[model samples]
Target chain A: MSDAASVQAVRATVGDSEFDRDTAPTRRAPGVYDIDLSAGWTILGAVNGGYLLAVLGRALADALPHGDPFTISAHYLTASKPGPAVVRTDVVRTGRTLSTGQASLFQYDDEGHEVERIRVLASYGDLDTLPDDVRTAAEPPAFPPMEHCFGPEDGPAPAAGTSAIADRLMLKLDPSTLGWALGAPSGKGEMRSWFGLADGRDADPFSLLLAVDALPPTAFEIGLSGWVPTVELTVHVRCRPAPGPLRVSITTRNLAGGFLEEDAEVWDSADRLVAQSRQLARVRLG
Target chain B: MSDAASVQAVRATVGDSEFDRDTAPTRRAPGVYDIDLSAGWTILGAVNGGYLLAVLGRALADALPHGDPFTISAHYLTASKPGPAVVRTDVVRTGRTLSTGQASLFQYDDEGHEVERIRVLASYGDLDTLPDDVRTAAEPPAFPPMEHCFGPEDGPAPAAGTSAIADRLMLKLDPSTLGWALGAPSGKGEMRSWFGLADGRDADPFSLLLAVDALPPTAFEIGLSGWVPTVELTVHVRCRPAPGPLRVSITTRNLAGGFLEEDAEVWDSADRLVAQSRQLARVRLG
Candidate 1:
């Protein structure tokens, strides 16, 4: 096929949202897909873990019969770069209420061998039919209005070649938690932020996957620096998100042995819990 | 082979502790093994999810070169009963720092069909070599002395066949969280307990898997009752536990559409964070 025809084939499967277009997966086989890692989604010269999760999630959602990802757990094996990649999915089980599966993202190396970047196990369900009885003991984090928060353009410019993701994601940090970016650190081990797509796309279940890990590592507030690489991340999509910027809060409860565990909760503009995640990462302190 | 000889072969592989013997997996092939699900570790007539995770963790640990499980995420597909089961492990990646793998627990039906009960993805590492730098912002829950807490024998007798696990694990609950059992729900969505093996085996990295999920569903304190089935659970083993009853606290922050998310933290007797877990379960409030 010609280059134009190939590009058209890929665009045909893309969804309406910018996130959808960027994370769109084109079916290559019965359970395999070809995806493009957008150049704008990198952090510290590597693709963001959460964006990679969404890319894998898109393939898992398409390969299975379900329409929504209920839970996704991914382990990052190696850093991935922008360009073409392959997603191979294996459906582990299909049930009436949920479907379980695994997807591995791979990038070819110099020797033309597939090198795995991430492996994920996820379960997908139809969220529209979920029961709506709400009982919440956790309240959304109180943050200043979006206008008062320090947004992407308001904060000190990130070091060059470090935060390309900021161009794709419009993140507004809680003023109190912004100390780490400056010379002072809060030592509180927590962070709160407003998360949204820079292209004005509303947060959805797939995008919430990105929003959960969108903020800077909570360890930054506790006086840790350098690139914190996520070893494992698990996100549970509780509800469909409302069409507005998400309220995100992350806390680092424990940091030991040069490792830390970060827990994150994302609430929709409607003040409902939409997603929750926990990740294990290495704290690179020089 | 004679029944006596078959039993001897299995006994040869069992470890020193009761937990080890109960969760031991006899290698069946390169990546497959046979495990006997002990009848004593049941809640609501089904095998405890955490116990089952340990069963899988054992197999994954044995299959890999690592000595400890760093993180384990499991998706419970169906109710697992106490009987003979099979564990199949697949190593996804082997790194110097961590080895990633997946394990699936399966049981046979009367018709001889293998049914998968739990699916797990985990990473194994050597905790001994982990850096000793410590920085923690989370503190252990302040409960009265262990003697003052409600031990298994002190609480109202659990319904027959409801909590067989209590017989195998000595769980002491904070008096305040025991209202759910005495006909007065706390409505606080939190539960704190001291966890230890009734058999007197000290908690290790393997058994810490069970300690994380051993607590009752935090939803029980918020006026929900019935067998809460865990849909997904992720446990991160932070550090090796000291030789004593581990302090555990679980809190349910959000419950919507009959679904809830529970976060648990386990601290060693020395007041060091040892393990942390989060689970998504269905709240059966009839």
Candidate 2:
């Protein structure tokens, strides 16, 4: 491709949207922000839950002076859309070691009335001050080295289709688990991958949110497909990730009464468990 | 002990305070209730996280038309005290399968001002309609039968002491993980126990909340002691548990700078994964 064509292709890959939400500010209000969600931060129909949390995190970081969010649990009341939305923050408590706050993202209806969409409860603290306890029983459940995982750069064009959010994130999944993307699921109820931010912004709490739910719905690997909408999601940041790629492992152990549960654990390249999260989702079938 | 004394002991074991919480309503108001959280609910000068969640669950159930909560993620912004506190709930959404709401528990100070202590986001869901999908890849980690595990009922009586929450709940732990109570702390970073509502109330969503955080902090098994207050907790109820005991497995995968992570999995008597939860806590040291 020519230099000019290559530049155009790069823009197309990023979908003219954004991955580093830290840079997506459009209009700033006193305690609210009209942030640009861009068009590419989604999968299928709804916006990606993690990417949404990152947006909330950026707005939250500005609202609280303690530090960036070290813990954020987001409840997806409804599916959010791309484009400009309002982020309104409210400080709940300011403790000696931690600060608690809540942020809501909404967009105005055609009638100019605000419609609330996502709600997040965030806790901010000094990540650098965390203890150096090296004793833990968890390591990102073992996976093959990154060289073997098939990602967008080294693999064939996506067979299940890719969206704007896909461009900003690099999730090179273990081949065996990506069978479902080709309409052939391994039937094991697991999704494993090597994940990271596309622009090397260095993994932080914001990316941790998206990374937690970034794995394709584990249901897709267990014979259930289509949009799997999450009703609720909670992410626990164990530590500020040691700047590097994250190992992702998400598995669904139960699919009862049309509802399923996904448990995710993220480990940074340093072999430390940086973040872990779980979500309750409903399986939408044909 | 005489038969009369034994009967009194049994009643004491069940404690006047509740673990199931369905029958523990003491005071009431419109979309609000003053629940009895007895002083016995604390570990070391602070209320247990699960008990706090149950208080929120009661208020949420009354606020929404839905039957109960299957998805309740609680954030412990402050250390709540036990007493006749008020539970105030606000409805966020009313969907067909679920209803979303937030509840805050408050107690008046000597000056008579309502002070908010804990905040909960509850997603009310009907347990009856859940699909009975038993096919799961996760199971209660292997453990000896209840008869083999130790409890306050058997072995050496609890040394760290018991609370009202403890009176209503029986935790016969897998012997391997209970070494810490004796001050030995096998140092395995694991705490496994066979848990249940001692009064035979049948395990429901509220009780499940108590059960998830019921396990003695896994950090105890790793040589860390004292208060260890939970900063945040998120619980996912997979399905209605069978009418019997629950097996709980809580393990800590990381403990850094004054903070630790606890992952809990609860399985019912039928060997079904009934609920799962994770939390971020501060390690209170001597």
The models' CA-based lDDT, in order, is: 0.87, 0.77
Q: What does candidate 1 score on TM?
A: 0.93
Off by over 4 Å in 1: A1-14, A159-162, B1-14, B159-162
Weakest lDDT window of 10 consecutive positions for candidate 2 chain A: A9-18
In model 1, how large is the Cα lDDT of residue B159? 45
Q: Write the per-residue lDDT of candidate 2 for residues A1-286, one digit (tens) a residue.
A: 7997676455322213346543344447766877866677778657788888878887887788776676787778877877678899888788777988888889777898877788888788877776675667665687888888886666563523567667777788988898887778888889999997666556777778889888778988887767888888877777788867889899887776777888888888888788778888888643
Question: On a 0 to 1 DockQ scale, where is model 1?
Answer: 0.70
Candidate 1 per-residue lDDT, tens place, B49-116, comes to: 98999999999999988979999999888789999999999999998989999999999999989999
TM-score of each: 0.93, 0.90
For model 2, the docking class works out as: medium
Candidate 1's C-alpha lDDT? 0.87
Error of 2 at B65 (Å): 1.2
